[model samples]
Target chain A: MYRYDEFDHAFVQTRVAQFREQVEARLAGQLTEEEFRPLRLMNGLYLQLHAYMLRIAIPYGTLSARQMRQLAFITDRFDRGSAHFTTRQNLQLNWPKLIETPDILAALAEVEMHGIQTSGNCIRNVTSDQYAGVAADEIEDPRPTGELIRQWSTDHPEFSFLPRKFKIAVTGAAMDRAAVAAHDIGIRVVRNDAGEVGYRIYVGGGLGRTPMLARLVREFLPKDDLIAYLEAIMRVYNLFGRRDNKYKARVKILMHEAGTETVKRMVEEEFARLPRAAINVDPAELARIEAYFAPPAYEALGDEPALLAAARQADAGFDAFARANVVAHKQPGYAIVNISLKPIGGAPGDATSAQMRAVADLSERYGFGEIRVTHAQNLVLPDVRQRDLPALYRELLAAGLGDANAGLITDIIACPGMDYCSLATARSIPIAKAIAQRFANPARQQLIGELGIKISGCINACGHHHLGGIGILGLEKGGEESYQITLGGDPGNDAAIGKLLGPGLAGDDVPDAIERIVDLYLAGREAGETFVAAYRRLGHDHFKGALNADRH
Target chain B: MPIVTERGFGPDGWATVADETAVADGGDVIVSWKRFVAEAATLTGRAGRIGVAVGPDFDVDLHVAGLDGVALVAIAFAKFADGRGFSIARRLRDRGFAGTIRAVGPLIAEQAPMAFACGIDEIAIPDDLAARQPESRWLRAVELRAAVSYQRGYRTGASVFDQRSTGGAA
Candidate 1:
């Protein structure tokens, strides 16, 4: 929600110009491919399996209607009329020409957006809860802090080339919707017993080949020392993190190798050496950033349960959608509507240009002209009124964006896998489609309840398979696609890495394998227990037997 | 082997002299930190000012206290992408080392702004790169509006917040 100030505008413009020159240099053979690779990556241009992919950063997953419209325009003109929303709360244009990337970046800058730091070994786009300012349980919005960090890390001289890529996620609510625990650095906004607000910092958490939850490095860091503290952590990691092996270069590995206590001591020593006041942003600037996320205008309407009930009774389809997709908002009479990108038999996070424009229009007309991108690759109209729900639903249904299966079995989180990514060992999209088709019924989904089935093409875990309640990791075994299952993993307040269940199965048999696991959950769940809770009660042995049931 | 500064191309002010070999020429010669430590007394009476060149692993703080007699400090990049030398330059500047800081590497013109911003007085690039990139590109790169960088003490760039505080608008 923070608009670009003059400095931000100038910064982006200068970067665009800089990249344009770099691209020209590459084309003219003035710079070799090796020299240009990192430069291109820093601007979010990746030479994927088939074509170049340009990832555009959506700062903290927040966007205005105008910005969405601009994205739709970019999709229509530059790409093949479709865009993929990534698990990191950003969008990727999968089929852009290498020559036209500068133009694409320039267009994004016009809408106060760009692909800066979306890739490469520098600090990535900072992420936060999609429901940041609107969530009922939020203590404070994390977007301001996220934006502040974004500014601090962009083109940072000391950290431009790190040992490896770094990720940071912030969460304002007690519920960790931003997947903070699985990031390089996680900041949970908290208040002390005396009511003074601060941060609880976590370091070295990541989900790659080796997934590890971040350790709490600082129990309570004063808000003023945020930048200085992060500088200390980065400096220590840059100086000592392993460069011998690419796989072992992450800060998490350093924490694992040297012990968290040693890393913490080093960071504390570095932090003590720096002048905190000189390094940190003025508190007034943070306040200025916070003001941009203040609640929009709302009428004095009371609770809308009765109105919503009446509308639901009139239309069963509307009722199912309202029941599943609508979440409680902090403001009265306003509801948070999640527009599912994962429809039955469709690729997990792909959206057409038309669907994007429709969502933009809906955001402007029904909501407060704002839209949010979720980590689960869904769109959210964060401030829709209860009275306008039916009308918005009709518009959404017509555009084929009316999936009533949010947080249900049909709403799968999947990476692009073998289809688009060169790193993928197996295809994840087809498996996601098969499972969604298997559980397509609304009643069946509602009965199954809050199940997150996340699929990643490879161990890089781009789809966040490590955090799903039902995580499916796709791999290759002797030239054939093999699917592996994990259970009880969560990305919330009590974050835990999922337990691996038995051996890999053929790609064709994955749907049935997931079905068998679901059947076990259905048979064993206690009253009011979610899939994760059911799995915790039953354990991996309970599901391992179910995995081989069909073979028997 | 051309060295460039903001002022322009100039005669090589400092020469790299071997540690054990004694030179009658003044302090214009640059020696390794190890050599500077081992041969300080003998090198102190030279006519030209003495400079010290450090590798990427050299601790700037370890030598900061003894910088009164040193006129210049040169840090090597070894590889263009390794940015540790920039941090060293900044640390030296922050610790009040008021001398000419040179960055030795195969860095191109694009990295000139970042090098200067981190407090490097000049970039002593390899002779081949100097021919390929040329001095005009370096001058153009250094004159970029990078002074509007976002970080506070990383550079003397006017921060967005500072601009706001001074009543500038987007």
Candidate 2:
């Protein structure tokens, strides 16, 4: 986790005071609703359909145990008893009042957190692989860069009021767990042939009314010119990006409508005009950020061959959890553990304050006092040693988060649809819970491996449904909530948008539609091939035909 | 006493004059419109001392881009919540609309901070607005918490970013 430096601390303090004054003005009726809307949004407060939702950024999805406890306190004090963890790896409190937001911000400031730039046409929270520092295949940790961008994009004057909300993600892992390809700006840290580190920059990728895989703007941007290159891209977008139609206003639309070649030329021209670097980023500063993320200490222990063998033989539950939730780590005797926030028959990604505190305690006890929230809405104890897995699992089971379904079909990514959001046409959480419960069989789930089913409440694509291998969009037809399924979508190194599968299904018929799709994949796929690969080979028309078979 | 400047457009450029007969004098004050309505012979040109007042919702590029002979462009808030005026001011700076660009209407004393952030050099507060203890121009205490002014948008990243200046003058 990147701890706040003095500069970060001072900046947050001043912002708290500044927003406090804005609240005062709004309360006194001096500031009209139109006047106060942008300001409120900038601070991560939104007047949603039901009540005000205050979104707090868990920057890059990293949080300390203390910070987790503080979040619990915020929900308990200023809002309802819990908070909703978003697909963006941020958290939202759905019931905080306008008057209480400043006080809530003041409390967050005490914990070195504030909601500045969390919303409203600014560079949003920078996300990355939740297991970046501990992932086995990662080239290097990506948090340092995530933090760097976090600081630079905060309170930016010129780029504040952009075409729309902008999102950036970075990753060091070769597998791209951050979904780098789907962000407005995605950077992958790579080592050059000279053994020097640089970045692979992709721009204009986003999911909304329009879904796009960010085009590669720079194959290798030097470590020194990250800021300049970013500035260059933003400059081009700001100058030439569309602002006439709100729907066609994102940089992705600009890249698409203006043609990538022209946008690239504009970016190149702007990059040439930038001033030279003076950020004073030395090896020492890198080391300082790295120190905060240093690998957790481990014992030089023999292989856990005996325990693993015994567990495989004695307990099918242990084998299922091992087969489902655990991912391989680079270090011997260590495993990256995912504490599932989505239990079978539970709403995906809804972590209570107590659950948050419990996860924090478990992290400190068996793993490090570090926690991470994945884009798939799972909390990861990234550096847990192999020996500590059992104890951690026990604690997690007690906390109701030990579902042991990390990548399985049951581990669904879903948004708070009509239940919470005013924009949603259909309910998402109930559908997710229903689907997860239906696919609760461990053997059956393992049979359908590496599958991602993302459910969004609407077309806004907040659930990254457009990026899912099988995206389910909830819609309202004649006032009844229905589910629309799309196929061939993916969010990985080879990212692509999903294709819709005809008309939406009745809410009662959603699980059957999903099963029908999975059954099609199962019946016609080659051995060891994932659902997405099989879909790409066979195409969405086949899956649609399979899902809508009963109609014709 | 407060003045409600109800600006409208004619073949002549931007003007607050609702009565066509009253605007004939042009008075000691210059004239301008609330929006850019295309008319071959509308309003005064940039060459004259005529000042244009842009409504909070008007596109800045329309006014800033055609400033070849425009003397001064004044932006109106209509109401304080209108952020379009701030952006209009920035566009003026970017396009090199060096002539005076002021913030008018129910602009509050609090928005004085954002006014400076968007390159608003001057503010025209409503006459009815309760004057702050010492008033807010020239002699007020400079209250900046950050190293730079109006740095609260996308440029919030720790690294340096670019601002488009193509709309402004050379």
Candidate 3:
């Protein structure tokens, strides 16, 4: 919802022209492949298996209806009629040719969008809780702060060429919906006892080959000093983050080696030495940024749940959807509706261009024209009137988005694995598709409710398997694809890294392993306890018993 | 006296020996370590339009002020990704150094607009690349958005010791 300022417009324009020349030079053979690789990557263009893939930044996942249309248009024109909505809240078109890249960039820029910093060994597209502003339990709307960091990190001269790629996610909710616990810098928005909103800083947590849950660096960082404080943290990481091995270059490793106490001391000492002017966060500017994320227009009405419950009594599907997908909105008479991108057995979060347009239009009609993409790979129409839920559900069902599996077992978060990502060692989407088919039973799904099945193609953890209660990692052993299952992972207030159960399982056996985990959860989980809590109480030994019962 | 064999010039072109006095004065002019701090005043403006190329080594504001009235061509040093010169060029422009702030470096083609975006009005590439590469053609693609991006750091306190030295002048 942030508008392009003079600074933002100018910066992107310069970058487009800069990349334009680089592309021309590469085509003309003036620059070698090695030289052009990083340059194009910095602009968010990657030469993939088939053609060039342009990963465009969604800017903390805030996009207008028109912007969504533009994405749809780009997909229909340049890509193969569908674009992939990534876990980072960006869209990647698989077939954008090298020749069509500049045009794609130009088209994106026309709408105040760009692909800068979505790739390369630099700071990446900042992720935020999709329900950031409208979350009922939020301390503050974290998007404006996210926008500020987005600007500060874009084409940043010093840290753009870092030891490795860096990612940052922010969440206003005490729930930590943005998965901040797994980012290089996960900022949780918090309010002090004095009622002033600030941040609880978590540093060094990341999901790659080596997954480390971020340690809390500060209890409360004043809103004004967010950037300044972050600067201190990054300086510590930039200087000390391992450069010898690319795999170990993440700040998480550095924070691990140095420990939270040492890092906290270094950050504080460095922050003090930093000129106050350099770290200066003007209150007025902060207020101005806040203006961009102004609160939604709330309408007061009497009991919507009563009316919705009456409507739901007539329809079973509506009742099921209401039970699963629909969440209580902060405002009265409104509900936050989660339209599942995961159709039964379909790839998780893979929305067709047409589907995106449908969601964009539905957003305008039922809720405000604001759609949010959650970390679970589901889209939320955050402010739907309860009166409109039945109507919206009907419309979404027609559009193939009303899957009613918001947090159900079928609401799986799987990475693009070998299908798209070069880093993936195995195919993740097929496994996810297969699992969805197996758990396709709606009653069975509802019975085994609140279960998380996250799949990563490899140990790189792009699919965030490390955070899923039933984590699945796809790996290749010998000539065949295999999977390793982890249990009790989470991305909430009590964030904890997933514990590995045992050795890897064959690809065909993954779904069975998942079934066994769910069966155990269904059997042993106490009344109303979720998989995570059950696993917490039962520990790895209980899950180990379940996994040992299954064989290829 | 260390022999001063200069390679680049004023208006950000190639440096040349103007005359016999240029040789005597220039031979001792070891451009390295000639910050205004070490050398005394009065003799500072003796070198004709001689400005120190601003890298991380020297502050442009200080060097420009000491060499008052001497036009300083902000040399980019290299056209391919050596961006320190843009900082030099921006600082020179911000500090009201009315001198010709030209970018002279290797791989100077198509970077003219980027140079201009950072406030460089003049550019001088390596003679060989310059001969083969048409720098004027790069001007046709003038950018609409222009901001002086010299001291933009990832973290505000992102210096060597976590102390921020970002946005040195602004």
Q: Tell me, by lDDT, which candidate is best.
A: 1
Q: Pick the candidate with the highest TM-score.
A: 1
Ranking by lDDT: 1, 2, 3
The residue-by-residue lDDT of candidate 3 on A135-231, one tens digit each, is 7888788898898788767655445546688899988886778888899999988888999888899888888889988888899988878877876
Tell me candidate 3's TM-score on chain B: 0.53
TM-score of model 3 (CA atoms): 0.82
DockQ of each: 0.52, 0.10, 0.09
Worst 10 residues of 2 chain A by lDDT: A275-284
**Docking model 1 quality class:** medium
Q: Cα RMSD for candidate 2?
A: 6.5
What ranking of all candidate models by DockQ puts the best one first? 1, 2, 3
lDDT of 2 at B128: 42
Off by over 4 Å in 2: A276-291, A296-306, A549-552, B1-120, B123-144, B147-170
Model 2 per-residue lDDT tens digits across residues A203-261: 89988778889998888988777766786687566555676787787889988988888
Q: Per-residue error at A8 for model 3, in Å?
A: 2.7
> Residue A549 in model 2: shift from native, Å?
5.2
Q: Identify the runs in model 1 with alpha carbons over 4 angstroms from their true place.
A: A549-552, B7-11, B18-25, B40-47, B60-68, B145-147, B168-170
Provide the RMSD of all predictions against the true structure, rounded to 1 decimal.
Answer: 2.1, 6.5, 7.0
